[model samples]
Target chain A: MTALPMEAEILTRREESPGLFTLHLRLTDSAAQQAYRFRPGQFNMLYLYGVGEVPISIVSDPREARHIGHTIRAVGRVTRGLERLRPGDRLGLRGPFGNGWPLGDCEQRDVIVVTGGLGCAPVTGAVQYLMRRRERFGHVNIVQGVKHADDLLWREQYECWDRMPDTTVLIAADEAGPLWPWHVGRVTDLFDRLRFDPAQAIVLCCGPEGMMLAVAEQLQERGIAAERIWLSLERNMQCGIGLCGHCQLGPKFVCRDGPVFSWREIAPLLRVRGR
Target chain B: MATDCTLVAELRFLAAADRQRLIEALREAGYAVHGPRVQEGVIRYAPVERIEDLPRGWRDIQEPGRYRLRQTDENRLFAWAAPAASLKPLVFPPREILFHARRDADGRLRFEAADGAAPKLAVLGVRACDLAGLYLQDRHFLQGAHPDEAYRRRRRKLFLVAVHCAHPADTCFCAATGDGPVARYGFDLAISELEEGWLLEARSHAGQEILDALPTRAAGETQRKAAEAAFRQAAAAQRRRLPGGDLPARLGGRLDAELWQAVGRRCLACGNCTAVCPSCFCHAHVEETPLTGARTTRLRQWDSCFTAGHSLLHGRPVREDTASRYRQWLTHKLSGWHEQYGRSGCSGCGRCITWCPEGIDITAEAAAIAGEEA
Candidate 1:
């Protein structure tokens, strides 16, 4: 809640892809770290000391309260600077902000996580949450799509999830290579093989708006109620809190009201261009 | 001490010359008094010591994209509709350092929260519209579950002196917004400026103390009537009005009106309207580091929706064109604000109309979007 950033040391770092990486951070103030709690879909305003901050989803499990993980794509000014950081390098962090995915509503119901491109990071935490409490849910299905086959980052992690009982991991590439083993075409193409009872399913989605819209349409046509489908939207989230006005969409502050919202609550707004 | 019963509705009269004494009393109480003064041909809030510091014997002639101050034979303070900006900067500063991060030789990064302790400030001659704007801003920064500490620290020390408008600008529509002409709330002392002296009413306990300390007499029936008549005339004189009631709903449905495109063609996307808007709270966090890179200062500077960077996400601007930007600002101010703050964001002070280089009249634009003539 404090606007001031707290110092968090980079405990570990991993290069997920050429322009994508993950940084495991631990708050220097152990007491503050212990006090910090975040939901699966929520994000943190990660600051690169001398550079500005960027809103990145927390990829670590909420159960691991002290250790926080953020997978970042070096696509902007702040993220490009963060790419140079290594273990033991310290940065500023302020967060555990925005409404996360609706895991509580997923109890005893199928949890379908849909993502596109680098959008898998936000949902990865939720998928991990479901994996830890595997017995409580009906089924787990993760469907991800990328522009190119080589753009996929977490192949091993998806393979690990595919081995879990009552869980399905399907990945697709728009431009498939000769050696690509997954399905070809958009994430919508993988829907035919996805296993879930649409009537009793909760779809958590994050990605490009076009992809999400297509996914929502596909799910609705397949009999999933609009209210059961949730989406995490991204905007210019400068302040983790709602005070900064950049992230507003219609009446909602994407950073506060949601990074995740029910399709029924946000569907009408998605139709408007340049909102 | 007088009984508490009469404090709520009591009115006192201060002689024209005694205004300086009131400023002195506030200064003695450790408040830095700021009032409207002409600076660089525009009236803005600045430090004031004597009555002469106020923009006396001056009235602003305001129209769409135009503002000019003309000297008047009669001497009166606060005859203008509004200053170039409201009291927003006094509480939420245009630029503020949130915190500082320093790097040590051993690669240890230490962050220190900026000391946000603010000076006790007393703003004089505030208008009803400005007060309404401040009230909405208070909801934005303080009423939330996680109140902004810096804004709270500054807001807690403010001593507001409200002034009922006796002359409204042609561009003003506070009357339509239901926030102006008469000072109703959010002030320690509400003043009704008259020709001979000033009629003051205490709305808060602090206001009563200042009223008691001043060389004031109980206002006669004639003075009270004059005060009411002045405020009434001000309201009736307004040539502009922003239609209320279901405006938020009405405007929400008109987001795609081609009028926005037309307005966009003329709109410069300069953000002058937001800069002068009393309730605009958008800011950008900027990091400043020296060439040596030993320390970094993170500061939040006032930002506008018109800027392409305001809606930038992954290098893509959500509102890529001026029309969309204008739509975002107008829709948010009229409709989106109601959903967020439970009311409209505009105070209808008309600074946006007067100060915009393109002279874009929000009232006219809103009317056009609603399929009405300006």
Candidate 2:
């Protein structure tokens, strides 16, 4: 059946940072809720009634079936409109679309999560999933980079995950203030402080294209095979089912073929400008 | 081989007057027949009740950025190739309401999916290239895991009557794409317009049934031979050809080529080429709110890669410049589409060429890239 936006009521709203917030929605339709199972990196098309729809990554753990969570930054008209949403407010949702992060592909391999700025939203669910089932993976590492210390969205969540056994969290802010207690540099700069078996590690990266490219290159230099490195890419995605054709990058429809792809598959196309 | 022989043996011929009988037969069989008719100065696909609705003796002359209909002495119905409009709009409409949402008096919001019950349609006079384009569209909308219910519903009982191109247009290069001049398959019935009468070949059981009921006679060997010869002539008349051998790789490797910059300079970013393209399927969603603002209907409208909004990411357009947008369009059609859809996107109908106001010939641009080594 063709995807249609089902009515969902905002159960809770949280302001993560300046102009960045997360909305927890409970599907008003019981049938829609039962059918709306999603993987870690899959996204939902949130339709703001009378405004428009925007593709937002599902930021909550996939295990939580009752309520779905979406972290959004007010970057465009639709996102800014979403900022006005309050608890009990009604909106529309159509998704759990796009290929999610290949958690199964990690298996017993070491998992390295790398993100910059608000790019962490897509990978947060996967990180939480890994933390819940920590025994399934070898080592868990979350490496993040933001322009300023205040730009970090989920500081408390990072702190919570950092204290978990066998999990490593590394943060880097380019312009750190007195309140900042993490490493003060670019994300690539934090690679020198971390130690892991590159052969047994699978890297998951998400950020601006340039940042992801740099991170992938750094990971490749550390002897991680290109096939083991996965990156969540972003394009102008509409109709998250791949029909709209906006999120096309080379041969891949980011909505269908992937928002999550192995670095080896996208490496050649990444070199091309304006793809 | 046996089936092929039997299929050819079942070929029938219909005189020009009996064409009207065929339309009536289709109508009696519960099909709303649609064909090309000269509306204003251009030929557009519209509902047809009689043979007079077809653009008879009115052949179109099409070149890059040029389309003119002129009266020819030939009394044949399928005298010309495809008009500016192709078979796209029949399956994928320009604008379609996906669904409607409304808030009730009790403050409960209700949603209704768009009704997908479409009228039984028989699209007549579809050219070989247009037929190929329709097949590609089917692959996208119906063959996928999540088939488009609306398109699938509309296409469920649809009938295709493919007309072989007897006269190739200047902009047309379907011969090069191996999709036109003659349609090998993917049509219910394939008609070849010969000088004497129409040589109709049934490609499917439904077509065979239709042929059995229509006013028709066995096609003579001479008529069949003449039809083949006409198709050959049409193919031989094509002046443009896409580069052979791994076209996807050839075009994909030239993303940074300077040829795109040259073509982009002339592009107005008006999206005319995409609008007229038989295979381009990009679309935008529009939310229609009434004056009361209590109800909203979401509509999907045809969109183009040329628009800045099409590639917008966080208030920034990915392909901001015309050069990049043009490159994305051509490369996706010729190169990336092969990997994405397991086939080339362009059916070589050349509607994009004739309809483009800037006359940006895709074939010319592709050839330039193919000619370059790097």
Question: Which 10-residue span in candidate 2 chain B carries the lowest summed lDDT?
Answer: B1-10
For candidate 1 chain B, the 10 contiguous residues with the lowest summed lDDT are B1-10
TM-score of the candidate numbered 1? 0.97
Tens-digit lDDT track of model 1 for A131-153: 99999999889999999999998
Give one digit per residue, the lDDT tens place, for model 1 in B1-374: 11111122578999998988889888888999999999998888999999899988889999988999987866689889888889999988899898888999988888888986789999999998999999989989988767999998889899999988988998888877888878788999888888788888888898888878899998888888777777767777777767555888788788889999999999999999898899998999888999999988989989999999999987889999999999999999988888899999998899989988888989889988987776
What's the DockQ of model 1? Answer: 0.78
Cα deviation of B107, candidate 1, in Å: 0.6
RMSD of each: 3.1, 2.5
Measured by lDDT, the strongest candidate is: 1
Query: In model 2, where do residues sit more than 4 Å from their true spots?
Result: B1-7, B372-374
Candidate 1 Cα outliers beyond 4 Å, as residue runs? B1-9
What would the per-residue lDDT of candidate 2 be over residues B267-358, giving only the tens digit for each residue?
99999988888788899988899999888898999999999999998788999899999999999889877876778999889988898887
